[model samples]
Target: MTKKVLYRIATLLGLIAILFVSTASTWYIYQGDTPEELL
Candidate 1:
């Protein structure tokens, strides 16, 4: 693939990861747990 395509894919993956982490943290907070407990 071209460099542009690869970069786009990487950017998309990063955004998805950020969204997933945020959602997980929110869920943890809702459950009365600190995110640190996930470690």
Candidate 2:
């Protein structure tokens, strides 16, 4: 694959990972856990 395509894929994966982490953190917060614990 071209470098440009690979870079785009990497960026997309990074964004998805951030989204997942934020969602998980929010869920944890609602479960009575601090977000710092997740970090």
lDDT of 1 by residue, 1-39 (tens): 699999999999999999999999888779864578667
Candidate 1 lDDT at 34 equals 54
- Name the TM-score of candidate 1: 0.75
Clashes of each: 0, 0
TM-score of each: 0.75, 0.74
Q: All candidates: CA RMSD in angstroms?
A: 4.4, 4.9
Question: For candidate 2, what is the total of clashing residue pairs?
Answer: 0
Off by over 4 Å in 1: 33-39
lDDT per residue as tens, model 2, 1-39: 699999999999999999999999889778874578667
Q: Residue 13 lDDT in model 2?
A: 100
Reference-based lDDT, each prediction:
0.90, 0.90
What is residue 34's positional error in candidate 2, in angstroms?
8.6
lDDT of 1 at 11: 100
